[model samples]
Target: MQKDKRTSLTDGMFLSLMKSSLKGISQVILIENAVTGFIILMAITIFSYPLGIITLSSSIIGTLIGKLGGANENNVNSGLYGYNSVLTGIALTLFLTGPSQWFIALVGAALAAVFSAAMMHFMRNTGIPILTFPFIILTWFMLLASYKLKAFQLSPGLVPQDLSHWTLNISGKVDWLEGSFNGIGQIFFLDSTLAGILLFIGVFWAGWKYGLFSILGNAFALLISFVLGGEHSLIILGLYGYNAILTSIAVSIVFKEDHNRFAPISGIIAACVTVPLTASVATWLLPYGLPALTMPFVLSTWLFLGARKVLPRL
Candidate 1:
């Protein structure tokens, strides 16, 4: 009887851990469904097997850290700790090139969880979601560290430039179909066309509402970017669309309360707002050679969410 009880206890614990870890992955896109997480895992796997492994491992590490660290049970169970870790790990891996890339990524993942917890505590009074701020800040700092740290090697793909010497690369027309799909993929730092489509399917798999907002976000951003004379090259690469997609989903569904009748409209406005914010942020970071990352999304979402606290009608 004692052995049987122990086995049952172990099984329960294993299942709980697995579910929490999967929730972490899904939470990357701000969803908490395990099936959605599995589909996203498959999406990344189809792009690069090793990255898929790193993504899952990052989620598990974040989840375990939360559990072992004795964070709030509700927060840990909600997979709050895992999302930033996953992004930080994968971003570091892709942004840095060296023998120590993997080690640094793992370290960054652990640090991301701690940073996330700390940010959550600090931001608790503000009522604004931390969003992906942890990932953005950690990545920027680590990337900058490469200039000083011998062990940290920045990828050749990203280079600092003089803004006065830079010119907009608007050499071609944007492909509407590809841009829409790639927007979703870009949220995970993926540039693969197939991965984007698969990610769209994964988002829709979570809920029709989520999928709808994602499409709305992408479509609005596409039209807005084109109308605003955003660089055609960046549009084609889905750079301008990713932050909008994230902003729409976050404001429209993930954080919307049932009493807020204007959430959908607010989401639309927030999504459109990210377009100019993206351009401004990219230009601001141009001299430093830092990708805007999801800073636009974080800022735009915060703008609307914070305003709603006072405006109430918005």
Candidate 2:
């Protein structure tokens, strides 16, 4: 019985970790199981301890709340109710600084859980997945409201990189490659190449297709940004590429199962389209200090998926 108890505890912890990792990609559960999920969290934690802890806390809290509210057992166990909370916590942590931010993190995470449930229910009949809309909505409100309170300030380290010293030559090429890796890491608020490497490994361990698409997505965005004469500094900082990476991976790997020829083509197109769209959207929201979050990915995927339903051949 003691051995059985230990096994059960281990299993429960693994499931929770998987749920937490799934926040990085809502449909990761479709590609990999609990073991892969655990590996992904290990990679994320190894990259950023605070991010890992906050993600785990929010996921567990959301899952518990969802279970108590009599949410579908399958949805709860599969992390459908938890991923948005993880994103909310990560978002708050990334943007806010100081001690009060911790308190806000907790409350924000809880509110995210509640909103996620409500959003999921309201959209149930629409047949469209809510995705990270709950996280986006909650984080936007928190960030906008934080401007009113003096306790909140943006992290000093979150500054844009200065690239006036470098010309778009050999060094630029190196920066782009490193930036591509950083782009993957930035999804979890990590800005290190090591973290990106680990994340790539984790995704690859889950399935090669996931890993491949992630790299492809980052590359596609970089190329598109260059052609569009976007600032090389933002690209090197990985600021302009992360959402496109996610958008590409989601449309290709998660929703479309057949690996249809158009699936990857569509993903590439979405990534290219989102780069300009993200920039344009950010321009409009400049007064709010909002960074567009993952709306580029969310909106692009929604458009593609919705269009696919009608176009069929797409």
> Which number leads on lDDT?
1
Worst 10 residues of 2 by lDDT: 23-32
Clash pairs for candidate 1: none
What TM-score goes with each of the models?
Answer: 0.97, 0.84
> On a 0 to 100 scale, what is the lDDT of residue 97 in model 2?
90
C-alpha RMSD of candidate 1: 1.2
Q: Look at candidate 2 and give me any clashing residue pairs.
A: none
Q: Which candidate comes out best when scored by TM-score?
A: 1
Residue-level lDDT of model 1, residues 225-247, one tens digit each, is 99999888778778988999999
Taken over the whole model, the C-alpha lDDT of each candidate is: 0.90, 0.73
What lDDT would candidate 1 get against the real structure?
Answer: 0.90
